[model samples]
Each structure stands twice: as structure tokens, then as C-alpha cells.
Target chain A: MLEAFVFATILFGFFGIILKKNLMMKIIAMDVMSTGVIAYYVLVASRGGFFTPIFSGETVAYADPVPQAVILTAIVIGFSIQALMLVGVMKLSRDNPTLETSEIEKNNTP
Target chain B: MNQITIVWIALPLFLGFSGYLLPKLDRYFVLGMALLSIAYGLQRYVAADTLTLELIDSFGVTLVVDSLSSLFILANAIVTAAVVIYSWQTGKSAFFYTQAIILHGSVNAAFICADFMSLYVALEVIGIAAFLLIAYPRSDRSIWVGLRYLFVSNTAMLFYLIGAVLVYQANHSFAYAGLSQAPMDAIVLIFLGLLTKSGVFVSGMWLPLTHSEAETPVSALLSGVVVKASIFPLARLALMTDDLGLILAVFSIGSAFLGVSYAIFETDSKRMLALSTISQIGFVLAVPAASGFYALTHGLAKAALFLIAGNLPSRNLRELRQTPIALPLWILLVLASLSVAGFPLLAGFGAKTLTLAGMAPWQEAVMNVATVGTAIVFAKFIFLPFSAQPEAKEGKKYTVGFWIAVLILVGGLVAANGIYMDAYTVDSLLKALIKIGIGWLIYFLIVQRFILKLPRGMEQFDQLIGVMSLMLVLLFGMMLT
Candidate 1:
């Protein structure tokens, strides 16, 4: 079920970037994509395993933990991209007082 | 030294942070400090070892250096030095952002890294830093360009992360060394998605849009070194498969030819520099595809070309002989341009000579054509300086440094002959001389003349061709594989 959500989020993010006219929506789409990929990573590895990775003390199915560790790095990457997008958005607004990609194109051409 | 690892992460971090800490330090100082840091880092990393990096592991990252890392470290440091100097030339008085400096340093930290997770962090930091540098001059257009770069690059990064995740799922480990232990072919194929992050155009669309639009010096870094940093990992992956190198070979020629073609037609100097970069990268890619040594040779030569390409002034070639570039600058420009053309006794010539000798089966003549195609394009550039008033900033403040840098680059190539020469028995001075002669012939006959649209058959790089590459890739990618 969570895999389904992750796939759906990827679509939402993909379309958000390709189809959205507003820069804000595009940034949000990027965020969605990042979240979806991370979700998929966790779901794929951590899913249903009867035997826990916990071999030390208990027979706990601790599940794979490497994906979780890797995800922390991905999360940081996502944040850096977000901060950059915001900076881009702020700069865009300062230049044209608008956040519309369409408007910027028109401004440049006209 | 093992201690050098933190300096890679810290120097830019320090310069970047200090800019914030001491807001009034002239931007030149920040830039100078960054240049000094990269030079020192490069000097030390010339012999840097691949060791267990504990400090990076706190963030679940492991920084290490091997031949691949050192090559990237050397290339990045060289370009960073050039970019910092150029940055100072233009914006020494303006309030340059500290973020840009941090971004540059952190990205270098990423390049020196050994693990996927840590590499991702560095990629993201570089992405943000790149975005801000592009948009810092502050116009609506700059912002949109920054967004476009951010969106495309980060999306590719996520794709790479997913590819990494899939590999991890199969292998249960995250370091590159560990990822190699996985046996799944499907997951290995997914690794191309990581190459996409490096920007190749089929799977990579960010190449044309992002790097082409960044500020001049920033564009130099983004094109000259950033794309290359990602390439080392891809090369590492290719080392795993015997056929993978051969498959990527076809794409390399196409990339080089197309990049040069676009550069020929391009008007803006920065955009032209960017196209030249893409073209040169085609050669860089071709090296690993042909042989690993080609990649190393291409890296050092191309990095030098791109770093200084920005500083050399240009005008259209048609009017060039009628007017003259500054004699000294013009001569320097010729030497640089010839180096790109693979003229004998220079860095590029040596690599081209080796590569020509290495081409398999019947592609030798075609490769020769491509070499001249590069010459044809550079002829356009070399003449540009003389066409109109040379725009090279007057009084050449760092003229000594420029000459020193050029000499070091030239000297490195001459020294490499002893190291790389013995591998290919057929490669010789005679072949090198022929390549130079052909390169010069093209410069004299066609490129130096009035713009006459040639019949499609005499085609040089990207022109008369690209409308066909999509179809070609469909067949080429499958056929080569």
C-alpha cells in the first residue's frame, strides 16, 4: 500500500515540474519527488521480513537499516535543493515582481 | 596528508563562512583565499590516499581518494583557481556572496568522497551553490534559469538516489566499493540514471539549460569541473564491464561533434564556452570509452582550456585578419586554441594521437574528421579575437600567473609522454605530425574564409547532423550495446 503511495507521489511531482506554470508549484513538485523516492527506498527494503536483522539478542526482524541511513543523506540533499529553489524564487521576484515562468519568458522575449 | 581531508571540506567552508563572519572583507580576499585553498588542496591531493574518513561518517558519509578522486581533485582545483581569479577580476568590489564560496568548497569535498550517500550530500550542496551563483546578479530571467537548473539537477539526483537505493536493496550496502559486490544486472543498468545526473542529454536534459545560463565564472566551474566530478563515478562503474566502455564510445563521438557544432554557431562568449565545454566533454567521455587513459588526458587538457577560455577576448572571425588581437594575448590564445586542436607537442595533441591509435576497426578516418572538425570550430574562435576590438581587459594584471598556469599545463602534458607513451606501440611522432598538419589545413582552407554554407557532405560537428542523432541513438545505443 505504501509503495502505491510512493509511486503516486512520483507522478504528482513529475507532472508538477513538467506542467506547472507557477514556480512555487514546481518547487513543491520537486519536494514531492524527493519524498516519493525516499518513501519507495524505505518501503522496498523495510517491507515484510519475518526474521529480524537483530541477531545480537532477540530474533527481531529489524529490517534493513542501510536504506534508512542513506535516506538521511537524501533528506539533506532535498533541503539544499529547496533552499536553492527558494533563493531562485526570491531572485526571480526581485527581478520581475512575479513568480510565473510564463511571465519571465515573456519579459525576456518582449 | 590524512589531515587534508578536512581542509577540502573546511577551506571553502571557512572562506564562505568568513565572508559572512567579516562582511566587509573585500570580495577579492574571499576569492583569493578560495584560490589559495584550492591550490594548496590540489598540491596536497596530488598524492592524497584513499583512507577511511571518520569525520564524514558522522553524516553517514565516507570520504576517500583513489586515482579517480585525485584526478577529479586536480581538475576541480585547477578550474576553481581559474574561476576564483576570474570572479575577482569582475566582482572584487561588488558584495560577492559567501554562499558561492562554500558551495564550491563543499562540492570539492563531495568529489573527494567514496560513498554514494556522502556524494549525494555534496551534489545537493553544489546544486544549491550553483543555483545561487547563477541567480545572484538578480534578474527574473536569472531566477528562472536557476530554478530550471535546480529542478533538473535535483530531480536527477533523486533518480540517482533511487538507483542507489535499488543497488542497496540488491546488495545491502551503500559505498561504491560495496555496491560493486551486487550481481543484479538490472540494478547495474539503473546506474545510468546516476550518469544522467552528470548530464549527457539522452537521459540527461539539464546540460544545455543550466550550465549555459550561469554567470561566466560560475558557468566555467559548472561546465569545466562539476560535470567531470560526477563522471569519475561513472567511469568507476564502466570499469566493471568490458563492453560498457565500448557502448559509451559511440556516444562520446556524437557528444564531441555536437558540442563543437553548437559552439561554432553560438554568439555569446559564455554560451560558446559552455558549448566548447560540452564538446570537450565528448572527448572526455570518449577516453573512458576508448581507454581509461584517454579520460585522464582529456580531463587535464580540457580543464585548462575551459578555465582560461573565459578570460580570452573574442570577436567574430570574418573580420579578424582585417583587425588584430593584442599581439601577446593573441599568441597566448593561439597556443591555447592549438592545444585544443591537438597540435603536436602539446597536451591535446598527445591525447588525440593516442586516441587515434586506439580507435578500433574502421572508425580511424571518421575520428580524424572529428579532430579536424574541432580545429574548424576553434578556427572560428581564434579568429574572433582579431575581428573586432579585442575585449580582453586592458593591462593584464595577472599576466604572470596566466603564463605560469599555461606553462604548468603544457609541462604536465610533456611529462605525461614518458608515462602514457609506452602503452601504444603504433602511436608515434609521425602520426602526431600528420594530425597537426590536417588541423592546420582546415584552419587555412575553410574556417578562415567568408561564411560559405558548405554542402552537407563536408560537414564538421553538430551541423547537418543533429536532426539525425535521435534516430541514430535509437539504433546506435542498441547496436553498440
Candidate 2:
């Protein structure tokens, strides 16, 4: 059930990216999609158990540490990419001001 | 001794970050790194031992240097050296050298890494470096192009990450050997992501625009080596599954035709070269055994052509006719163009022959047709008038970088004689001539007749995302059967 919901979040983000004409909206949609993927990784990590991965003399099950570690790196990468995209968007807005995909395309073509 | 492969990845990265502080010597730093990498690659190739270094034993992150990867490392080194030399005359910013050096390291890392997790990190590093390089011009237009490239590339990589997670869920390992236990859906997702990165078919539609818009040396790097980065992984995947290989064959052939058709109609010289890169890469992907060789030859020749294109007064095909090139540069252009067109005695012919050897009969026929199309596309450049123009003396001054790049390419062509000796057969030569003849005839007949235009909407960002999603669904459906 949780997997289905996570997938829905991903699909929703994709739809937003595909349907949104504004460049800023598209960037946001991309972020949402990345967040959904990260959530999916978290869910995967949780398959081992719900408890914290750090062992402290507890008998309860602990989540998989590998996926958590992997996703941590992925999260850093994702954040940096998002920052770069936003910076690009800020630069782009200076010239066209509207930041509409159509207007940018018009200016791009010869 | 086995751990030496790590230095290939480490040295450039160290230089890339540290070179920034020493801005005046950044170019020399990059040049030294490139030369050192080439020396290391040569030493490894001559030793001919497959070296592997385990980073974290449990995590399966390994660095490997085999014959195939060593060749790529060598190619990357040579191209990096040539690009650095070329950029010297262009007077590029210190930032460009930093990114180029970092890109060299990341590309080498991508080739050397042995598992999915490490490969992902390396690819992301490459993406970031390439993004910075593309946007180095700092124009409104380049920023937008770089942004689109990053967004689409990251989205595709996220899908790849999800696929890697799926593989881990099933197999409990990220190594290529563990792929045998991977689910079909996971493989399909990985395939789609790599397809987009390699600029194959619908998924890679961003390539032509992004490659053409960048500065000349950056375009050379993008088309020459960066685009081939994903193919290394895809080739590994294809080797593990016959189904994936079949799928690769289909998409590669499609990409070949699509790229050539676009190139045949393109008026912009750089855009035409960018499109031809898509097509030539198709040849590389078509045959796994020949991929390394084909990629090396194409990388050298294409980088030379792009460096030469940098010297042109106008990029438009019609405008180029009014200006005649100098004799020496004209010869260099002819050699590079013919080599790319797979002329006998040049490097591309041997690579093309090897690629053709692995294809089924029908696919071979299609490849031959695409070969002719490639000829037609380059014929536009080959037949340019070489007569002296009044402004040619002042308008065109060949720089030191230009000569250096051409020399590297020429030397590469000369060295390729050993590899292509077996491909020199009467029947193969005859077939190559016939293809070129047909292509030349077609070019002459339709020189001014056809004006083809692909849909503008297809290249738009939203449409690209839509196309990628649709391809995912389609590939998943195919995998079910």
C-alpha cells in the first residue's frame, strides 16, 4: 500500500514536470520527483525493520543501513543539482523576465 | 600494483580542484595531468593485466582497469590533452580548465568503476562538470541549455537509481556479476536511463541543441568523449542479457538513421556534426566488441573536425561556400571528414567493418544504408571549394591550438594503421566505394532540393519528459513479454 502511494507521488511529479509550462514550476516538479525517489529508497531501507540502524543493546529489528547510506549520498547530489537548476533559473529570468518555456524557446532559436 | 588504477581517477581530481588556486598555471596543470594519464594508460595497456581495487569490500565498489577500459582511458587522455591545447589559443577562462580536468577524471572514473553505486556517483560528477563547462560562456541562452540538460539528465538518473534499488532488492549486490539475478523491469529502467544519457533515439533529443549551442572546444569534448560515457555501462548490460542486446541493436539502428536524416538537412555546421555524433555513436553501440575501438577513432576524428570548425568564418553551409580554406587546413579537414565517413585506410573503416561483423543480415543492410547517409552528410563539407578568397588571408588565421589538435588526430590516424590492417580487403574496399558513390550521387542530385524539418515541439522540455515516460512504459511492456 505504501509503495503504491510512493509511486503515485513520483507519477504526480512527472505529470507536473510535463504539464507545467513555467520553468520554475518545472524545477519544483523535478524536486518533487527527486523527493519521491528518495522516499522510495527510505521505504526500501525500512524493509529490514523500523528501528534505528544504530545498535544500542536492543532486541528490536533495525532498518537496513546500506540503503540509508546510499540515499544519503543521493540526497546530497540531488540537493546540489536542485541548487544549480535554481541558479540557472534565476539567471534566465533576468533576460526574458517571464521565465516561460515558450518565451525562452523563441529567444533560443535563430 | 593493482591499486594503481585508482591514481587514474585521483590525479585529475586533485589537479582540478587545486588548480583553481593557481589560476595562472591551470592550463599547464591540466596539460601535465593529461600527459601523466596517457603515460599511465600506456603502461597499463602494455602490461596487459586486468587490475581491480576494492574500495569497500562489503559494498562492492571496485575500480577496475582491463584492456577495454584502458583503451578508453587512453582515448580520454589524448582528447583531454588536445582540448587543453586547443583551449589555450581560445583563451578560455580558468574555470573552463578546472571543469575540463574534472570532467576527464569523472569520465575515467565512469570507465573504471565496476559497480552500479560507484558508477552512479561518477556519472553525476560527470554531469555536474559537463553542466559547468556548457554554461561557462555565461550567456542567458547557455544557462538555459545547461539547465535543461541537467534537469533531464538528473531525472533520467533518478530512474536509474530506482532501478538500482530494485536490483539490490532482488540480488543483494550492485556489481555487474549480480545483474544475472536482476528483474527485467529493473534492467529496462536502467537501459532507458543510459539510452537517454547516450543520446540514443527519442530519449536523447536534448543532445543536438545542447551540443551545438556550446563553445567549440566544449562541443568537441561533449561529442567526442562525454556522450560515449553511458555506452560503456550499456555495453556491460548488453553483454549480460541477450534480450538487452537485441533491444540495443534496435535502438542503435534507429538512432543511426534518425541522426543521419537530421544531419542531411542541417544547415549549421556544428549542429550537423553534433547530429553525426549521434549516428556514429550508433555504430559504436551496435557492436560491443568493437565499441572501444570505434569510440577511440570517432573521438579523435570528431574532436579534430570540431576544432577545425572553430576556425570557420560562418557556420552556415551556404555562407561557407563563399570562403575558401587554406591548403593545409583544407587537407586536415578532408582527412578528418573522410575518416569519419569510414574511408578505407582511415580509422573509421576498420571500426565500421568490426561493427558490421556483429550484426544480423537485416541489421547489416540497415547499417549499410546509414553508412551511405553518413557519406551524404559529410559530403557537404568534403566538396567545399578550396580556391583562395580575398578575405581568407586575414579572416582565417590558424592558431597554435588548431594545429596541435589536428596533429593529434593525424597521429591517431597514422597509429590506427596496425589495428585496421585486417579490414583492408578488396571486397570491403569495393563496398565502401560503392556506398560513397551512391551517397555522392544522391548528394549531387538533391543538393538544393530537400528541406526537412523535425517537429519543434518534440525538442521542448515538456515533450521530452513526456517522451521519456512513454518510452519507459513501452519498454516495460516489452520486458513483460
Q: What's model 1's lDDT at B305? A: 51
Scored by lDDT, the top model is 2
What does candidate 2's lDDT look like per residue over B1-481, in tens digits?
A: 6546556578888898888898898999899988988888778777878887876655666777777777777778888899999888777878899999999999988887778888899889889999999999889888888887888889889888888888888867778766768888788778778888888987878888889888888988998899888988887667756667777888889899989988899888998999998888888889776788888889888888888887777799878877776667778888888888889888888888878877899999999999999999999889876754435455567788779877897688658756658888999888988998899999999955677766656788777788888889868876776
DockQ each:
0.43, 0.80
Q: After superposition, how far is residue B287 of candidate 1 from its true place, in Å?
A: 3.1
Task: Give the winner by TM-score.
Answer: 2
**Candidate 2 has what TM-score?**
0.97
Candidate 2 C-alpha error for residue B171, in Å: 1.5
Interface RMSD of 1: 7.1
Q: Please tell me how candidate 1 rates in CAPRI terms.
A: acceptable
